[model samples]
Target: MSSNSPSSPLRVLVVIASSRPGRLAPAVAEWFVETTRRETERERMVVDVVDLGALALPFLDELEHPSTGVYAHEHTRAWSRRVADADAFVVVTPEYNYGMPAVLKNALDYLYEEWAWKPVAFVSYGNTSAGTRSVQMTKQVVTTLRMMPIGATVALRIGDSIEDGRVSERPMLGRAARQVVVELARVARALRPLHLAPATDGTTPGPVDGLSLSRVGEGDDVSELLVLQRSCWVEEAHANDTLDLAPLHETLADVQAWAKTWTVWAVRRHGRLVGAVRARAVGSTWEIGRLMVAPDQAGNGIGSWLLAVAEQHAPEEATTVALFTGKRSRRNIALYERAGFHLTAAPTTPDDAVLLTKSVAATTLA
Candidate 1:
């Protein structure tokens, strides 16, 4: 699937917020999705229907705060991924006692950063108020998550607009539903910058929002980094025809020990550690290694951007930056060369690995 960035196709998650048996939420969501299908495809928008009834998520059960992004259960992580993958949202809901459904609120409370910087639209149904109060209540919670709630909405009074548990196929209603998607796409594009976490030094923003960069430490960062390294090096392992790679074989303790001496940095996107790199001065040359980006996010210039960031952390006494990869790793070599590193002779490199180096001045000037 393509990313939900400004330059990529937009992914709209249609959330059916009611789990009650025989509820009309699914019908409402179906109407919204079908109405927008043709126009959405033409405009590079993908609508995914997610029904709370089918998902069957229980009440929130995690131990840590949602803001921490440390999920103890697979369900929470799965939920995080779905939310993180979306660029916008459209909720199909019914007002209950003049407010949003409790299940909807629980789902919203389960994850923090995933919902940040996205736009949410509403398709509501109820009696007298046409579920407008539910939307009003949801808007308040979504705003607190840094989500943008657009002005376009569809409110349906069951007595007037619904038939046999399904929304009536009215042309005006169809137009309104399509308009909701149109508005969501525009707002998502405008709010893309909020996805970027500003640099800690306040010099520049991150490549995407919710980026938290810091020295590697305890509390899941090391374990997450370890997992990322193994995941990212599979391609390298295949390219080199070897399973002896340290990145794949290294233990958690190995990573922890190295972090104590190396100037290690981890980049978390929306509380998930998606990239990392480590560097330390080896005499006059800065030995930078273990640079990795999530495979799904590769080819987006994150690796290159992260490599440059690692260089900036080099000690003042360092005159060169050096790294290594398997000899047959063409893609890695090409990326390095583009970043101004050249393959160099080094007998000290591992049996199947090759070294590359660049003068600090050239790298800095570039």
Candidate 2:
């Protein structure tokens, strides 16, 4: 996991798939990126342009299967990392003999797991067929990698859509390009959980049975966390006998702001965001907050499991771990008590809230 702030943008990589000396792939890619710049920024996406002509990957030379992940050359490793880091991909390609360029296929063949469970959009250009056949051939290969090929695409006929070696400026063409990116973003986000949490083969220890836990990363969306916090805090309002609560009232912007300073962990079960917790070392004490589990997922020991996971992330210098809850929220207090926390007096806490603390040997946690 990359451990990026929850509000970080989706990483959309634009790939120019022609390596010939005088090729129009780069121009087409640039036009698409510029055409969709406004929507990309509005949707909180980050675009990175990758020109395969500059990458210079040779024909497949590794002896091992790509799934084994053992690359014999530095070029393969570099390409692997680039593709792995992307949340979604847009391949700008030109038809070659009515099929995708061999270089594009070679690039796709360089890695296995890195490409799975992500969305791919295509902007294809060529003659009469407008490169639709190339897209069809590429779709067959991409599906084998578990990459979803979206229905929305940009198809440009070289003669009709290009002018002076550049894609012509036209409102309808720009709109089509923007629509492809918009739909790609939608599918990218929708399929993010699958990309984040792959099916484990039961060899490694996890937070709980059937639950996958990992550090939150840059491309992870915080909208789900905001909704989970509000849903979980409603119970606290009833128990505490007051409507004034930070979690209950914190806007999405507020949550995003706090996420920057906190090292957060997200928990999932079967591809659903089920729980999350954030912790940061405050002086010698580790402060843990925003611990939550979906309402329907409560009472399955997820809260306790998540607390243990959060504590494991505490800093070495921290001798104490602390958290706060509504003063009258007995259920929360009881849960904390079972995890070795004790109610403590704090002058800085609001009258309606109570702080809890637990001492742990710094050496052990370190």
Candidate 3:
């Protein structure tokens, strides 16, 4: 899985929804990706092909509900990661018995949250109805998963669009395929806030309207966190007039290694990683570190919100939360001070850094 910065390329996964041997689905998908390749590059987006045949996911077998995001099998976990990492989807489906194929249906049934709040477009091919009946049948299922299906679509009749079991070189059809990518990109960008907002199961709402707060996952979020951490600390290095900042210099491996010892929370708005913080219990004190918010997203109380969240995660035996920042980072120091953090006069503190500590009462809850 690839991580996305706000300025990085958007990920659009094109799903070939057929699994039979010698199927036309691959050829159709190839045409669509080639047709849209130039446009996707120009728009700062990436197109990935996911053939259901290659995936070979079994029928839904997990005993737990998909909404829990608890997969009992390795295949389900891999599938969940792939779907969760994508910003949008384009399903290349074919009609079967006047409806969607069983493989596509089974694939959709295997996960829940991975499909939510993203845009999906359909490129369907079949003998009659241009495989539109299959698209119609799948639309209701997508809606139940909180997915928004776009209006632009590509429907091809086998007799008219296929030649020698391949999609023919029709200019109009190629243009329509490109248009599907354009529309999907626009709708996916527009609908990103829905994808980023925190889940509704008593999750805390962020200070910003569309901001989401959640624990970071291992594979998909690690790289994004590394990018965000570096992007955010560039401002700190400038403010402090020093190139010795730790966050600005940490590698991907360092971030991954730290996650094992820390409970990390990521913040997103409109499907873009904007802020993050990590904390862990060090004996009786909850040690918080690496609090960051994007330079453009600052002054919105995200840092304070994340700090409160980290403090809330402290163990019952914890009596104080502690952190350190650049000595010249006055804005950050003020924010921490307002959150009841006071300068700590520790003898071992770095010469260029200021240490801050906040007392945690037993009844304190975030």
lDDT score for residue 216 of model 1: 74
Where does candidate 1 stray beyond 4 Å? 1-5, 196-366
lDDT of 1 at 204: 38
What lDDT, from 0 to 1, does candidate 2 have?
Answer: 0.79
Off by over 4 Å in 3: 1-4, 197-366
**lDDT of every model, 2 decimals:** 0.79, 0.79, 0.79
Model 1 C-alpha lDDT per residue in residues 1-366, reported as the tens digit of each score: 114223667778999999888799988888788888887887688788898878877899988687655566668767876776677899998999999999999999998767877899999999999999999999999999878899999999999999887889998899898888788888877765455222242223454545666777554488888889999989889989988888999999998888888888777777777888898988999998988999887644456557767876667888999999888886677557645677899878887989999998875544
Q: Of the pair 2 and 3, which is ahead by TM-score?
A: 3
In order, what is each prediction's RMSD in angstroms?
A: 13.5, 17.0, 17.0
Which stretches of model 2 miss by more than 4 angstroms?
A: 1-6, 197-366
Using Cα atoms with residue i matched to residue i, what is each candidate's TM-score against the true structure? 0.59, 0.58, 0.58
Q: Which pairs clash in model 1? A: 195-209, 196-208, 196-209
Candidate 3 has which clashing residue pairs, if any? none
Which tens-of-lDDT digit does each residue in 6-122 have in candidate 2? 235778889999998889998999889989999999888889899998998999998868765556676876777677668899999998997999999999998776687789999
Which residue pairs overlap in candidate 2's backbone?
Answer: none
